[model samples]
Target: MIDADDVRRIALSLPETVEKEAWRMPTFRVAGRMYLTVPDDETSIAVRCPRHEREELMAAEPEKFWVPPHEASSAWVRVRLAALEDLAELRDVVVDSWRQAAPDRLREAHPALVPGAEAAGGR
Candidate 1:
């Protein structure tokens, strides 16, 4: 099953990614902007997600995605690690959040990491 360690591994694999402590938890950042955070219990992750997409994701899969009341106004969503399908799904989700926080130059330099890049022949 995908776990906190898997999250860390996939996040760190991204270009220019770094791990930092915030709110007493581990937060993954790119370009100094936080994109992923593993909460205290390490069972869930808060990731950068546009409000619109976040709502749709939660509505589509409430078991896998949600947001705490305090973070409702933020563009972020909490994902349950156990609900994730596999490591590939975890990588996809983490990479998507990383893309949101990554600078344009970094994204451009790492096209293979971008979602759907493989189908577009990036890899």
Candidate 2:
């Protein structure tokens, strides 16, 4: 099962990522903007999720995805670590969040890592 250590390893392995403590929790940032946060006790991880897609994701997998009341109005979603299927899925989620938070320059520089970069015709 995915856990805090798994989150730490995956998140920190990404490009330009840094781990910092905020609100007594572990936060992963890309170019200084927060992309992922692992709350105390580490049952789950919160990451950048487009608001338009959040509800559908939650509906699709309630056990895996959720919205913390405080974050309901924002473009973020919490994912239960235990619900993840494997490291590949975790990497995908983390990469997507990282792409969403990364600057244009960073994204461009790391097109191979950003989801849909090649699909979107980005080289």
Candidate 3:
């Protein structure tokens, strides 16, 4: 099963990534944009998600996902690894987050990733 370490590892795996302080927690970013963040207690991690999917994800899996109190209302969902059985899903979440946070020009330049290249080899 995935855990805090798994979350940290996955976030740091993104290309041209770096970790820094955000909301008093460790946050991962690409080109200065946030993609993933470890919450204060480290029990969960928040990832950037499509605004459309926010409610569905939370309603469908309240124990696994939630919307944080004070940021991007429908664009971020905090996920608890203890409630997630599939690591692939977690990877997809993080990848999507990465894409959202990546610079628009960088995304335009990386055609392969635009279609989610990371999903192909993810576990």
- Poorly placed runs, candidate 3 (over 4 Å): 72-74, 108-110, 114-123
Error of 2 at 74 (Å): 1.0
**Steric clash count of candidate 2:** 0
lDDT score at residue 95, model 1, on the 0-100 scale = 84
Ranking by TM-score: 1, 2, 3
Per-residue CA lDDT of model 3 for 29-86, tens digit only, reads 9998888888877778888877778888888889988876776555788888778777
Across 32-99, the per-residue lDDT of candidate 1 in tens digits comes to 99999999699999999999999999999999999999999999999999998877778788889988
What lDDT does the true structure give each of the candidates? Answer: 0.87, 0.87, 0.76
Full-model lDDT, candidate 2: 0.87
Off by over 4 Å in 2: 115-123
User: Model 3, residue 27: what's the lDDT?
Assistant: 89
Highest-scoring model, lDDT: 1
Residue 38 C-alpha lDDT in model 1 = 98
In candidate 2, what residue range of length 10 has the lowest lDDT sum?
114-123
Q: Which residue pairs show backbone clashes in model 3?
A: none
Model 2 RMSD, rounded to 1 decimal: 3.7
TM-score of each: 0.93, 0.90, 0.79
Instruction: Score residue 15 of candidate 3 by CA lDDT.
Output: 71
lDDT sort, best first: 1, 2, 3
